[model samples]
Each structure stands twice: as structure tokens, then as C-alpha cells.
Target: MLDVCVITGEDGPHTALVISAGGVVSDAVAPPGTPHLRPETITLLSALLIGDWAVADASPDGARIEARGIVAAYAQFHLERSIRSLGHIDRTE
Candidate 1:
């Protein structure tokens, strides 16, 4: 299962999308009164995930930038986590 958190804009609220192993998406968690994601946004997210730079670049600048930021941040977070785990292993050895 993969949980993706998307922030619509720089100051926008966060929406979490849960994707299962079989590629089923569900459990979108957003604040009360938050509207559903636009089709364009979903397409942009899909494009970014699949490394479709052309499609991703066609999205609105703000949306594209925000999506890229989210992806970068997620990568950085996991990288740091992996580094920390390696440190722990080194100490244990």
C-alpha cells in the first residue's frame, strides 16, 4: 500500500490518497469542506508518477511545481530514513 499526500498549493490543505498493491485507489482524507481534486490535478499526478515529463509539463505551473515539490520531499524523507537505519546497523555491528 502506498499513501500519497498531495498539497494543492503552497498554502493549500493536504489531501491523502491511499493506493493499494493491486493499483486500487481509495481513502482520500482531506479536511472538512475540501472539494474533490480536479481531473487536471489527477492527470498531473499520474504523469509525474509515470515520469511522463511532457504531460506533467503541460499542467499549470503552480500545480506542476507543487507536485514536484511533494515528490522531492518524499524522496528526501525516505533517503534520510534509510541513512539513519544504516547508521543504526553500523553501530550494532
Candidate 2:
């Protein structure tokens, strides 16, 4: 199963969303912080995905938590997202 994490962080009025696919995908909806691309998010995401944190109960809409788990790897490729989205993404506005 492809567990996907829709990480949406906000810096003041600006917001950035990063969707990561891993095991036990989770969503952390807390007050967003400054917009910056760091490995911090990937590390947190890995912990959530591997630990099987409360993703299943937390998401129920188009979002979901898969039971099969995934080979959680730390991937922080802003360029990839940008290219894939056709320059539709950025860490900052």
C-alpha cells in the first residue's frame, strides 16, 4: 500500500503542501512555521510513517492510512515536485 502524507505547512499567510508516500502515512496539523525546505520534514515524516502514528484515525476523507506499510525513505526533492507540478510549487511565495 502506498501511504501518502499530505504535509501542509504554513508561514504566516503562505502555505506549502508536500505529499510524501511512505508506510503508515500521517498528517500533522499544527500551527505552520516559516517556509523552508529542510530534511526536518522528511525525518518527521519517516518517524510517523514507520512508527504508525495516529494516521488511520486522523484521516478519513480522500486521505487515508494503509495497513501494509511501505519502505519509508527520506526524500526531500523540491526540484522534483516543482518539475512534476510544472513549477507549480515552491517553499516560499
Candidate 3:
């Protein structure tokens, strides 16, 4: 399972979100501030999957963001897989 944690500098905290082989976000910490995953984060996250590392401005709809070419295209699949497994690394306490 993959662990996901949305670290907010405001609160000193540590947790994990498990992404099983099936790609389900079973648990989370609900990181403070935004209840919903930021679209821009998702977009940038998606791009990161392909080793692009290019940052995105973020949006309500993450999938809509354009993917700028990544410098390391070979690793894109690994990043993409991790992004595909994304659900919520953080949840509120």
C-alpha cells in the first residue's frame, strides 16, 4: 500500500494514506485547509507521474490541466501510477 500525507506546515503532524494494489484510498488524515483535493495539485501530481515535475497553477478540476513535457519521460509511468492511486493522503481529525 502507498502512504499519502498532506503535510501542512501550520500543524506539526504525521500520518499515512494506504493505496492498496487495487488503487483504493482506504484511509486518510484529511489535512487541514481544503476538504477537497485541489485540482491544481492533482494536475501537477498527474504530470509528475511522467517525470515532468512541471508545476501547475491548480484548479477545481484537476484532470483538465494541461501536461507540460517532463524532463524525465522514462519515469512518467511510475509517477502516473502513483497519481492514479491518489485518493486522500490527509483527512481532518
Candidate 4:
């Protein structure tokens, strides 16, 4: 699951700041396609997901604001799975 927000630049293009459960962070064109995911809002989300990364100039949506909790929950869930999977890597021998 991906927690994404659609933010339109002052000029017009939309961009998303995304954070993965495994602690990956990046920015990209909003509504990512194919296999890529979108970004999160510029707020506590970035801080919660990563230590120093920050979110900036994100569009404010009341609907999306509420989703932060849900997204965080899922991200944590995924993170747990990722940790468990790492155990298998060591056993792959």
C-alpha cells in the first residue's frame, strides 16, 4: 500500500514525496505509473518515516489528512514483514 498526496506545483505539474516501509524516500511526478509509487504530504510523515528527510509545500486535503494514520499503520505492517524476510536471507545458504 502507498500513501500518496497530489500536489500541484505553482507552475502546474504534480509531484509526490513517497516513503516506503523499509525507509526509502524520494520525490516524483504525482500519480506514478506502472510499478512506481507516489509521494506523501510534507509534514510529520517524512519525519516519522525517516530521521532527517522533510516534506515541503504539499497541497492540503482534508480527506487525505485523515489517511496519515492509516498509511502509517500499513507502512509499519509492511516493515514488520520486511524484517521477517531478512531472517531468511541469512538462511539462504
Candidate 5:
């Protein structure tokens, strides 16, 4: 149940790449001509998502950066969700 979102650029839309033990699902909403992620990139992202630092660290610089960016975006998204959900908590005694 690992979800990774990579922010392509300031004006570009984000791409969602989901990886599960069962299989991989991608919501790549990029422009028409945009290329899909490379296999190495996916491997690096999986390693980063599952906390396999050895594999992640051994990846190429570009792949590592891309994967880390995706991981960071995913973390930020979850953090925002957590913060928003806090507003729904019952605070009364």
C-alpha cells in the first residue's frame, strides 16, 4: 500500500505511482507527450518507499533524486491529510 507522488515541475502536474506487494498501479496524469517513468526509476522508488536504503542509495544519481522527490511529495501529502483530519477530532470533554 505504498503511494508515491512525484511533482514534475512548478507548472507540471504531479504523477502518482502506487506500488503494492500484489502489483503496481499508476495514475500518470502527465501531458500527452510525456514519457513514462523508467524501470530504474521505479525500482529506486520502490526501494525508497519500502525503506531499502541499500538499494535506493546504490541507484543512479538521477534515479535517486527522482525517487526521493516522489517520496518527499508523498510524505507531504500524508502530512497535509493528517493535519486536515485533526480538524475533525472531538475536542470537547
Candidate 6:
């Protein structure tokens, strides 16, 4: 799992920065029609697909605690909601 920071413009546009557990970072484009998904989800999923992070959850509804506990915690704290819906996707496919 990875840590993610979503950066949004004041008027429009959104981007994501995903930070791997090893400290590598990658930027990603946010999904176009998934408002239920958080920027954190977009960032992490993008990183996983791009091979930025060494781990993969393979699910976007809710990542396993064993696989993405940190991500879950981070999302809950930062995004102020559960990232279940976002956790169960594979955009790269």
C-alpha cells in the first residue's frame, strides 16, 4: 500500500501524488467520473498500475487490512471517510 496526497486547483482540475512505503513518489490523474472515490484512491491505484509501489491490492471496494492498513488509516484520517469504494478498483486494466 502507499500514501497519497490529492492536489486540486482552486477552480478546476485535480492531481494526485502517491508516496510509496519506500519513499518514492508519483503523480497520477484523478478518475473522471468517480466522485465517490477519493484522490487518495486515484493516486495509490495509479501508482500500483505504474509500478511505483511494490504492492498491489487488486480490489477497489476495500483493501485488506493486512495489505493496506496504512492506506486505510491514512484515508480515514485525511479524507475523513472510508475509502472502501475507491479501494476496490483496477483502473489500469
Q: Find the candidate with the highest TM-score and give its number.
A: 5
Count of clashes, each model: 0, 0, 13, 3, 0, 8
Q: How high is each candidate's TM-score?
A: 0.42, 0.20, 0.24, 0.24, 0.45, 0.24
Better of 3 and 5 by lDDT: 5
Q: Give the TM-score of candidate 2.
A: 0.20
**lDDT score of residue 62 within candidate 3:** 32
Per-residue lDDT of 36-74 in model 2, one digit per residue for the tens? 222333344444557756643444322221211111112
Candidate 1 global TM-score: 0.42
Tell me the tens digit of each residue's lDDT in model 3 across 15-45.
Answer: 2221222111322444333223233544455
lDDT digits (tens) for residues 1-93 of candidate 6: 223333322222233222222222333444333223355454555566587654454444443332354445556666666777766766444
Off by over 4 Å in 1: 1-39, 81-93
- Residue pairs clashing in model 1 are none
TM-score of 3: 0.24
| Residue range 30-66, candidate 1, lDDT tens digits | 4444334445666687786788999987798666555
Q: Give lDDT tens digits, candidate 4, residues 1-93.
A: 123333322231222333432222234443354123233443434444465433322434532453344455455676664333433443221
The candidate with the higher TM-score, 1 or 5, is: 5
By TM-score, is 1 or 2 better?
1
Pick out the ten consecutive residues of candidate 6 with the lowest summed lDDT. Answer: 16-25
Of candidates 5 and 2, the better by lDDT: 5
Better of 4 and 6 by TM-score: 6
For candidate 5, the clash count comes to 0
lDDT of predicted model 1: 0.47
Q: Give one digit per residue, the lDDT tens place, for model 5 in 16-88.
A: 3432112233344433444345567777766866899999778887775565555554555756543445447
Which stretches of candidate 2 lie above 4 Å from their native place? Answer: 1-36, 52-93
